[model samples]
Target: MQKNDKIKFYSCLAPLSFLYGIGVWLRNRLFDWGILHSEQYPIPVICIGNLSVGGTGKTPHTEYIIRLLKDKYRIAVLSRGYKRKTSGFILADSESSSWEIGDEPFQMKNKFPDILVAVDTNRRRGIQNLLSLPEKDKPEVILLDDAYQHRYVTPSLSIVLSDCHRLFYNDKLMPTGYLRESISNINRTDIVVVTKCEEDMKPIDFRIIEENMKLRAHQLLFFTSIVYGKVKPVFPSKACFLNHKNIGKEDDILLISGIAAPAPFIREAEKYSNKVVPMVFPDHHMFSKSDFKKLEAVFEKMTSSGKLILVTEKDAARLKNNPLVPESWKNFLYYLPIVIQFCNGQSFDETIKKHIITFSKNNILQNKYE
Candidate 1:
């Protein structure tokens, strides 16, 4: 659709968006007035989520927190497991697949097998289950993934991420826009992170973002940019080893992505190769046999000798052990991992550590007194 047509379409949905906003407002008020209760766990619970509905790099930020605290304290991650086939509080194990748990949860479980990862629709119940584990196995710090709107569980330290490309302040409610709640609701968060920032972002850019956010005095703000890692084979056992820095101008890449934000990924891929053909599916899409066949066709048709297929790490989680993937495509398929690099790295680290330390000390005092 043209720009005008798109604007008209969103305009048409404005009323519905208003209705949705009312429902969200009422629910929040109920919690605020004590008509509905928001459960608070004694152990430190850190929530990493976003006000907008789509990708704000929650997973990488959550991983960043996990890496910061995993060594010092036993860590567990709980997610709503969006689009998973299973239900209730199911803990991840070696036998778990992306089908059983969501792709993001499964990916984290694969990367950090020692850490506890579980999924459930009910965030409160998921945390309860994690806390109920045997004394030695119980988690000391529980990371709540994508739980900003899950008002039932009050986190000890809530971090809300916003995409640099689409700040919540510039967005409306669902249908008309991508936000799950009012921009005013941002005050509920302890920290706000602007994700997917340019590596060389100017000081002026940060100032503009901070001014637009109008954050509360109690809230902290930080900016981060994506740092793409070396390309690794999705099927490492089946594919021959290739040097990570092998991609060059001569290569043609077939970039397959099932993510909310593909522009950044595509732009990064374009930097490596002259020709990049992207095949984008919906976020959290479960690739079927037809999707694999289409991918096989796209990769096979590329005439360049240095042609290969590339995907995001999240997509790789869903495709890794799938039976539908053509055998010929395995050798050429690779996934790029990403982690966030904070603008004020040391400050962000210190702030997270301080929250955890304070929580631990208070918990100890309470237990001793009891």
Candidate 2:
């Protein structure tokens, strides 16, 4: 976290990253020489992925794509289902829980009940399963979560997301730094999105990011933000939504979250309630016996201190399905629904729509002939 400590850390990773760079070169060479083949999907596959490990807001962007295309196209989302137990292709259903389908997929399924969602370690198999389904069930466009480094399949349109606060150009690969691949790999992306932008990004600041960024011939940049949901109240007995009348009338607010990045939730929670009791666990930490007990203790403390419990929609995504959350916090707990919003407004929408539609149409025709 400190400057000298970080320098020492990257110092260790530098040599290992150099070796890792060699491996990547060889792999790309094999594919280039036509020995190792890249798989192709029948339909247009747009990948929303990143180079880093956590907190780029890909899920919100993926959800945004789902929301945008739900009415027009038969859309499906494919994820590696990181940290999930299962190996084979798993489609989320009404009966599906986080344990079975993973956190993000289940959240997507719950958000857009009409859309199809699935997860698999082997993406090709997942695509095969979707193709095997009836024509009407087949997706016209499939969104792959965290597939930027996946060279096995060639995505029709690849959108690489980077945090504006923590751009890859400023950092290095992990062990060495935090990059998954080399700066040259940015060439693979069609569009580069600057996610989680500060609301008041200046023109000069935008230029600094672009100038430092390792860009290919036509790689585009877009800025986005987390659009927080409306502030609501916690009732005692029934499910009561918040309105103007009961804005700050809640007893107190308790913030609980389990996300790779809990900053957004904490910031938003603080905006509504100054006295917030925050409960955060590790990312993707499934509830264990002790974990549940800890949460119970935290809840008890909050209640005793006269605070109502509130959680991110993501934490609630898993907890609402499970029995870990006690009946006491059940009525009080709430989750925030976030969506990726472009700061530039219509210009951003137009650019994304233009590129995707053109890419989809062109890829469709090309695949039809091939």
Candidate 3:
């Protein structure tokens, strides 16, 4: 069920949420008091994460950072590999599958093959492994994807994202709501981003959000909206050529998404076609043979002559190269790509670049003196 569908039960779960909040508070306090250490690395480490459990657009934001810095720096991305089958630190290679490295990481490796992508539950260990590489291969900067609560490694620049649709300020602790921790913890961040905002959001709406967040003078705030790219075939070899422009009112879209949030994706599909049938699944859900059979059944039942199967880029990562997917469905399977566009993009870019430049200069001076 969608998060909105569970809202009515939040009151009943309040007691459980309170207990969960207490445990979160104590753990954070331990780290704050230095009873639990947070390791600091010499190289620049930027974290893109959220206080909420999922659907804040962390992966796309991480990809944006990679695009910004990859030209000037050797970049490395470290993630927990959320639902992968493996358990140790593993760097992505040609042979790596979404089942092995997690879908997001696998997607990154495929999109930006030049950069380093590694996964481990231990953030510190993952960083150490990346740093141990030869000088040419060692990354100059490390991007931590979804490590906000994993306070074992202190990031040089911490960016926390909140979905505009479900702002953390309006949210509650787990069991009752989506927040992993208290909204007060947002004060620890260097930058806060409101993700998945409407492209044409009014100025008044922006001010309303800004006032509610109450960020510190030292913290930077930005708003970003999703920009859906062209529809690309998941299985290019057997795909029937189609683009977003080709989709029309007469079309019937069978949208298959295994993401935390599918509302936005469904809305996008609805713009082109009035008839949209969505098959929603849990985040990081692995598609099985039974699921494939259901998809086939659904697609075959659609009456429109112009019918297609649509999925998010993250879901496409898991479906790609899978043995269970039937060959007949390949022609209709396509995934939409999404990228973030900041309200004031130049300012956001400059802020990130300035920090990296300063870090590099300081590191050089320290090396000279030592």
Q: Which model scores highest in TM-score?
A: 1
Which residue pairs clash in candidate 2? Answer: 13-175, 13-176, 173-177, 173-178, 173-179, 313-336
Which structure among the candidates has the greatest lDDT?
3
* TM-score-best of 1 and 2: 1
Off by over 4 Å in 3: 1-8
- Which of the two candidates, 1 or 3, achieves a greater lDDT against the reference? 3
Better of 2 and 3 by lDDT: 3
Please give, for residues 164-273, the per-residue lDDT of candidate 2 as tens digits: 87788877766676778777778888888898888788989888888888576677787888888754433224445653224363446667778878887788777766
**Candidate 3: 10-residue stretch with minimal lDDT:** 1-10
Clashes per candidate, residues 3 or more apart or on different chains? 0, 6, 0
Model 1 Cα lDDT, one tens digit per residue, 317-355: 998757788888888888989999998989999999999
Ranking by lDDT: 3, 1, 2
Worst 10 residues of 1 by lDDT: 239-248
Clashing pairs in 1: none
- Give the Å shift of residue 63 in candidate 2: 1.0
Candidate 3 yields a Cα-based lDDT of 0.94
Q: Rate the local accuracy (lDDT) of all candidates.
A: 0.91, 0.77, 0.94
lDDT of 3 by residue, 46-133 (tens): 9999999999999999999999999999999999998999999999998899999999999999999999999999999999999999
